[model samples]
Target: MRNEKMNTNPDAVRQPLLQVSNLAVDFGTVDGVVHAVEGVDLESAPGETVAIVGESGSGKSTTAMAVIGLLASGGRVAGGSITLDGRELVGISENEMRRIRGRDIGMVPQDPMSNLNPVAKIGTQVAETLLAHGLANRSTVQQKVIEALSAAGLPDPERRAKQYPHELSGGLRQRALIAIGLACRPRLLIADEPTSALDVTVQQTILDQLDEMTRELGTAVLLITHDLGLAAERAQRVAVMHRGRVVEQGPARQILEDPQHPYTQSLVQAAPSIAAARLQPEVFQTGREQDAAADAVADNIVEIEGLRKVYPMRGSASDFVAVDDVSLAIPRGKTVAIVGESGSGKTTTARMLLKLIEPTAGTIRFEGNDIAKLDRAQSREFRQRVQPVFQDPYSSLNPMFTIERLIAEPLEFYKRGSRAERRSRVRTLLDDVALPQSMLQRYPSELSGGQRQRVAIARALALSPDLIVCDEPVSALDVLVQDQILTLLGDLQKEYGLSYLFISHDLAVVRLISDYVCVMKDGALVEAASSEEIFTNPRDPYTRRLLASIPGNELGIAS
Candidate 1:
């Protein structure tokens, strides 16, 4: 109930850094007019961090783009006013907007890979922003770039500046983007899902850096994200958006503790840390039952013994051991979560399990058959039983195919049924994933991130396979939608008795769905234990560190 008025003066009343009111945007296309944003009102006072929370297509990103005057071609700002320090921005010519952008307001886009030019060196990109804003000359830009990288928490900034975008990790690339945004010392910084692609540790580091930089520079921030936990952790105020409108806005504590809207409530409740809210004694009793069942059925649906994968170093003294002597068993109808940092061999293990690459040494067994020895025909059959849901939904589904076609491809390739039966099956799968039947004809480009992921899940289930390797399936989804998907997976497991080898770095999520947990570090399994055991009494220091890294754990939010 903090009613802070938006400051209208550019130099008086400590001046609100940015003000946006009744904004609307539309994209005219061949099919129809796409209403991207509508009637959105937001503001950020000097040195305040405000978070915009919503599911995809809720106008969060579009609103930010509109404020910065960066909407794509054919995308028109249909209505509203945007003022940066009382300077009108809506309807301003591109040339005027260009002069304002990067100098007064800066943006950090979602995907680092696509946002940073692949061909440009990291230092040059940051320095170019400074030069364009007339902040520094070519000679001084290099020094400024290094300082900016260092300020962004990138290690060895001097060397990192010389490297291209591809050379840095996902976390580093995101930091590089931030460095470029902060290079000019803009009064307002807009970050759109900056940590969506990073692992948990890297994400924590980046967020911490943002908080520190904001405090130091006294910069106003507009953070756009689907992760409510992150918003609660970083922002002072939260705005909840849905269906192209802001449904609720309040202080961060009020929104997190007592959400006024049902959507906001569901978002907080759906968080894995919050969902696992029962008493410790109750969870322990459930764990006992799980332990007994695990002992009764110890047979492996998929097993990897002494697996090793090596990548030859380019003109180096030694090769890299991506997966070193990794051994594990995935039991039927059970969920095994593999938790690790980036480059810790989690994805490599998944790739090896899929037989995408032959292991350097060891055996992989699928239902008692050695998949490593399988021929082309046998490998195709194996693919049917073990399907994968990739991390990025945007790239996983084809842009040209309709939802029905995408889901039906697996069934058609396997020749499971007649054309009529296949169509019925596709409809059923879509329904199972809680998608509308009207979405059948829409392509991947038409759907939101969560919807596209649901379609991917529907396709994965089309095969009716025994095992599914979900690779960070819910990482890209909003909290509320993620809960629905996790609940759907649980229901599907009960119905079909399917087995899953879930991989993720989100410890809270791993605790929610996994029966067992395997901790990996440096391409090796550091520890393996039941979920309850792992949470209650972690024997390894690394495991404890990972658990400590989870936000809200120390604050009793997990309760």
Candidate 2:
């Protein structure tokens, strides 16, 4: 553990470079004015990192956006004092703030897909930042852009620079954002869940590089993340936020190890850690019923043998093998997790199982029948029985549809019941996912990330699917919401005898939910075992390295 101490004394001679006092932010919505952040006090010295940890709606990101003077439309500071090098920023003009944005205070926003310009080349974006900040001119911008991308740890910088944001992988897009944020070497950096899209090993590498770069420049970092372990590992101080207020703020170790606020304590409890045991649902705790149910089926529900997917390159004879000889099985009413880094073929394998894409070579059998061999009617039945809960709920759900329509779409699609019955089924699903009936008329945009996810789950369960392919279902959610979603899945599994083919880069999350684990690297399965055996005694070096990359693994925090 790092032995750094926070300077908390009010009478101290040294002053913070970035100071936030009594900050409040409000958003004007259709309902009325909503206070998104209130009375939040935080500060960070040069060469220091301070993290704000909270749930999805806790206003951590709002506070960071406030600091950068980039609040969304309909949002206003309301009341606050934000000082950068003793200069007040609240009343500054947009032009002045623009000047300060890239040169003085950099921002690495979440959601690289939305943040990065789809039409712009990667090099153009980085160059724009450099040129706008007067760090480089037109003549020198290209080299500087490549240098920045290289600094952000992007491989093949020259080729990557020429590609558009859409052409790069999620991890690459995130790195490009990081490159832009750190291009000018700003005095202060606001990282709003900057590494959320990255894999654990890449996350560690990026954070390490960020640490080194910021240290050299004496930059202050205001990190907003839902990840408690990452906050504890990377930041010197941690602030606990709840319902737009800073409930507690102190040294990282003190806040996480001995959380004072009730909200903070709940966050610690809900956060999935490597030290935590596999969470058992109420039904599973008493193994008698579950054991008997498992015995009755006595066979795997889905099996993959020599599954391989190859993408032909545009101009080359060689093809890209996304999933190479991936073989795994999902038992009835059990979770079989595929854990790997980005581009390691976890999602590819899941897509194959879903029949979204065909395999170049291999077999995917569902209930002793090859999915590829299914006829039209059989395929329709298979589609009803096998469903998917995607990673980003906001993207997955149709914004035009109400919660009722979204959940009941599948029921209506297969014409399972009358309109009244489908609506009734939607209500039942809402209860199954622990959502209120009042949400039926609400749009997807009106709900929080967790609520949106519940709705997605409800939609998946609309047809009473035997198997649900959950592709990083809870990765975008906060700790509390992640725990809730996992619990709901477990309960639903027990009740409906549902099987799960789970995919995630989060090892801790995988540890909590998975029954069996398969580790993949470079499009190949490196290791497979029971959850207990895999985590307790990983056989492969790649698996061990993945485990070791988990943030705060060294702290040994009690789960």
Candidate 3:
């Protein structure tokens, strides 16, 4: 492994820490060849953070997997040269790559849930990297593992080290993965959406930790993420990829402040923070306007009174209260956003509202009726009024079914119309969501992330639902696509007078679409107020911390 240090002069150009020239990856399939990555070129300077920004299917992950020699079966690097410290890596043997992976270049994958070993203790998995590189002996490894865990900012590191991956929250699992990546103290680190699954507070902490570690260790970082605001705040340089190609690359400030590429400009404009800056003051009325509107009759659509959901652990003596006496209301044609960290009971509340799970106590009222006490037939009718749009579009939609069939199935199940009428309604709904009729025959695998999400929205709207529970619908999408989805949701609400129970961890998204905001922490509601009130004058300490944790919150506008 190369550990050459560059000159310290600001004017002096440093030698690249890692470089890839004309990289291409191919996978063989029954129908045809899948060109996952094509002629991609990227490089990182020593001690500099380089960000790769792109939408899904832009070959960002494929590039990272290729660099680390972790590509799936049937996937091969067909062409190009990958050089680390001037050494060739394209045709390196598996053993050689494995030796270099953790010792020289480490990686933090996108999804910690699947990346971690469910049955193994997190400490053991983190220590495995040190053992692989011969960095510590069995006697000393335990102490080193604890140190790594602490450095990654896991609370109660000693206790957490003994827990399995399933026992930890999503943010904690991600931190454990980072701990593993940093165990070997590699020269370069590849972090792929490290904070994608974390809440605002945890995300900020992770980013601050990563920045501090990289600066202290003088390690080069290659960050791959869909969050433009995060890239602008953390990275020195940015590379924008589109359709498996680098369409733009330059300094972060230059690209964000004065982007020359159309795609880059679109991404910057579509950023939630930037959009909020342009629209916040207008959408959030002043004190006078709010006072005037207060006298106007407010329309109420859905109400909950002390809703509680408790789950009993099989071996545990006590039950866990996922939703603890949560109470809130959703106004007609308004969006109510629920913000919280993982295991904060956001999803559990949504499940109770959907009636998918029976609440241990409390009342759920939909349009002045007690939904919790409803019979089976009434509950079925209530489901049609309230629909759900789940996260993970890839898994939410059935892969075997066509778009048309998937959309029509909901209408058929509700018995709202005949076959011909349902088919016509499906086409209309597709159009409403800005999807083309041509996509009706295609399967889920044939569509993009944004496209599939649009299909999911169309399916949800099949019954003309009064309220839609959007569970992080746009969190996984790119900036441009997320903007489109948000705008579409707003338009749908305006046109159809549809209400929304939006659940997400992205503060910027909440600021954009939410008329009211609810903050949750540790299975409890910290505060519930108007969006502007929550943003300007949060009564709860946790809510203030969340707002402060947003990237570039100190700045007046989005970076």
Candidate 4:
């Protein structure tokens, strides 16, 4: 439970913290003048949170960037007035903005991995903020850095400070970003999708930390996110953006319960968390939904026993066990999701199941065949039987290749058909994923985040594999696009009788898509049960805490 309450004092705020009126921003691109934001009006008071919700390319991030005076080249304020406590910031000089940035305004950018320098130590990054702002002298900077990390919920800040960005888990990296954002205790904090990359438990911890700190410091938060549930739960006021304009703005509860705009209504109804079709067997299953209990365990498509993976320490004789005696079963044509923190071995188990990584001790039976004992020819065939959709689509996709080539490469690798035939298969996969055939000629950089993920899914399905391992497929997408991808996967599963070994940290998404749920922690399975049992009545303490951590779990909103 939270030790303190924040977002609890609306009446205490009398003075306006940030005010933006009739804001308009545009980018001069090679295509032409692109109007990113138009006629936007928003305000936030001290000790308050104003959430701006929208899908990607809906001007939410652009508005925040314009307010922060960090808009990239070719982008300028076409029309608008941005003021902080009566001080104009839109036309401010860079040097002046730099002084105001950390001292008066702090920001937590969306992408933690790219925002952080790969070569620098995390401690140095945190200390640099305090030193640059003249908040602390060199003598006390190290201690201040450790304190910031500790406050951000990172355990053993002393050791964590020396590690680089790659050495930490995704959750730790996000918390590091948070520590940097709040190191100066700025009057205004611009947080853009702060918890979008973290697991549920870690997301709650980070949000709680932010709420407490902001409340204590009287900092106004301008949150830019696509999660309607998060806005409904944490924000004092909600602003919904459609296309390039704000269509609705009001109290959080009022906006979520009774949205006035059609765009807002569509967003709420399309979200997977609202109805949770995955936990309901009747909705997720086919005609045999009622007979699931009567089905035998032998109906599983993949079975594992005593799975263990150990990696040797750098210099020590000891070894690190990533997956410890983990066992699970994936029923034929059923979706079983594994949920856990980043390093909890969910990905490791999935990798082993796909034979991408070998297990030190265990037996993985795929269709009653031991994957470990497969010969060269059999292994080659196994590659065609199983496919994987990685977590990061941009990294997974090759920038040099067009979307068509990326999808056709798998078909060509397996020698499934001729050049013309492989081209036909790629088109069919594009149609199945709801992508236009015209997009085949474009490179990965030309597509948006959601479109790139869709292309990745199309590539994964090019082989028509019997089992597909989707690792955090929809974590980076907005709720509307996430729902579309989920629906596509479900439809494909039913049409092709495909089985899925889904791995994700988002429990709300897990509950919405999985027939069975497996909870993992510290490289072990803490609990495994049907989706309904896990969501409705989790037995394990860890599982219960996880259930309690879903964003907006405590709120009750009307339809």
Q: Is candidate 1 or candidate 3 better by lDDT?
A: 3
Q: Model 2 Cα displacement at 526 (Å)?
A: 0.3
Using lDDT as the measure, the top candidate is 2
Writing each residue's lDDT as its tens digit, candidate 2 over 370-477 gives: 999999999999999999999999999999999998998888889988888988899999999999999999999899999999999999999999999999899888
TM-score to native of every candidate shown: 0.89, 0.95, 0.89, 0.95
User: Clash pairs of candidate 1?
Assistant: none
Give the Cα error of residue 113 in candidate 3, in Å.
Answer: 2.7
lDDT tens digits by residue: candidate 4, 14-66: 66789999999999999999998999999999888889988888899999998
Task: State the TM-score for model 3.
Answer: 0.89
Task: Evaluate all candidate structures by whole-model CA lDDT and list the values in order.
Answer: 0.82, 0.88, 0.83, 0.85
Off by over 4 Å in 1: 1-14, 29-35, 155-163, 274-297, 554-559
- Residues 1-559 of candidate 1 have per-residue lDDT tens digits of 1112321234432567788889889999999998888899998877678999988778888889888988888898999889988889987888998998898887889888888999999998998899888999977888899999998878899989989999876668988998888788888889998877666677777777666666566678899988776777677788999988998998876787889899887667766682362212123424456557658875779888998999997666999998899988887877888998877888889888987788999899999899978888998899999999887787889898999999999999989899999999999999988899999999998887889889988999999989999998988787777777777787777788888898887777777778778889889998877777787778999888887766555323321
Better of 1 and 4 by lDDT: 4
Candidate 4, which segments miss by more than 4 Å at Cα? 1-14, 279-297, 315-318, 555-559
lDDT score, candidate 3, position 497? 87
RMSD of candidate 4 to true structure, Å: 2.8
Pairs that clash in candidate 3: none
